[model samples]
Target: MFPFINRSGTITPRLALIRRMAEFTGLYSWHWTPAEAEAFTSHLRSGPKPIMVSTTRGYEIPIQMFCAYISDSRYGWLEEREQRFGTVPQQVFHEWNTVLHVAEYEGDPRSRPLHYDEVQRLFDAADGRAEQIRARRMKGSVSAIRGAALVKTLYAYAYGLRRQESRGLDLVDLRRTPTNRSWN
Candidate 1:
């Protein structure tokens, strides 16, 4: 049986404040599989952040665009992490050295192209100087979409198209000039 009207509760702001602070600083526990836990710890023992293709133009693009532009080897990093680590590992931070050859024209995430001149510019800037090159190698994940699949995904993203399934483009199609390209 419970006691009747037990008035043990206090309304002091100081006690409330201390309780709030404790909650704020407390280490909230999360359950993870062995692989996930290992990967999380691996993250703590990390190195560098991924070098994403950011623009000084004061704009942001969906990470999917960058995913489409990079190589299959990079994507494999993501796949393995997903399989072994049970989460996308800290590989993004590891890929600090990579540079995405972004296109000159910018638009929605679905249809922008990796620009020709911009790619050249990025390479020129990264001329292997001690300061110019990325300092540390980090880790992260990317879907291993290469060749035609990559081009199609990027094209759709650049043009603002949303397809349920992947639509691979021919290598020759991607090689065509900007004028010849069409989006649906």
Candidate 2:
């Protein structure tokens, strides 16, 4: 019954495993550099739930830690950080896992609107070559900025949805809210 509810056609057990894996490994993945992770976590603390909790009606279980948004701190793969430091910081990993669990259990707010500075930091933190290419593509136009903005927003929203669904939120609505509304 729950299987049919999956918009992505994934099985419930598989979804459960994915959510669990993200929960267990998110702290260790270095998916974002440590600095970025710290910043992202800080942003959450400064803003909304820090953890978004969502549930399916009639279900006895609830999912947790839906998303792990990284800030612009140490921006690189986990391995790089590990290789450089010989180990990942436990405190960082702990906080990351905690926030991720919250994002997973709670429905992530669709758009975490970023200010210009944050966007710039994200650009710097992302792959250097990719950022360069993206910047070049922008060629300094309002359209370029708009395009980048759309991509970032979409990426964040998709990540949140995936994390939520993995945790059993099983979100079905991908519909965009009115543009006039703020996503913060």
Candidate 3:
């Protein structure tokens, strides 16, 4: 139902899950049944290093979501597939075979994220330290400012950027944008 789900970024991982499910069932998509999915889940749970419930759900979500996307009426895949393959894609996943959302942060307590206020306080402390260094005309004032900027930038793009990668950046690596006419 959503455009983002159709994008390559999302589809690639979902494709992997789809392949695994197909491999497990030894059946094509149209012939799939919820029983096979349940068997797959059981296999995951009984493995030597039995997967965590959450990890099993991670595999289930992608396959379920991708199936739902293809089965949607607006997507026209049902008609196209039925005509070409002589069968429609079946959604093997069901509530009975998949995990239900109950509560979050079920993992290690010590690894929990900081609250919003704590994050804000951390940023404020970084900026204040930079200002303190600049006020006293300290030798490392520039470095302090750069450190604060790195903190903010890391927080802004935390998923993609790393602290060491940011530290390695040079002024020469930045260039002016054509439209904005500002160094980036």
Question: Which candidate leads in TM-score?
Answer: 3
TM-score (C-alpha, index-matched) for candidate 1: 0.16
Best of the candidates, lDDT: 3
Question: In what order do the candidates fall by TM-score, top score first?
Answer: 3, 2, 1
Off by over 4 Å in 2: 1-140, 160-184
Alpha-carbon RMSD of each model: 25.2, 20.7, 7.0
Runs in model 1 with CA error above 4 Å? Answer: 1-135, 139-158, 164-167, 177-184
**Can you write out model 3's per-residue Cα lDDT over 108-164, one digit (the tens) per residue?**
467656667877897899989989988998889899888887776666544335657
User: What digit string (tens of lDDT, one per residue) describes model 1 on residues 82-110?
Assistant: 67655542212123333334655534556
Answer with 1 or 3, whichever has the higher lDDT. 3
Candidate 2 achieves a global lDDT of: 0.44
Task: List residue ranges in candidate 3 displaced over 4 A.
Answer: 1-16, 27-31, 45-58, 65-90, 103-114, 128-138, 156-184
| Candidate no. 3 TM-score | 0.50
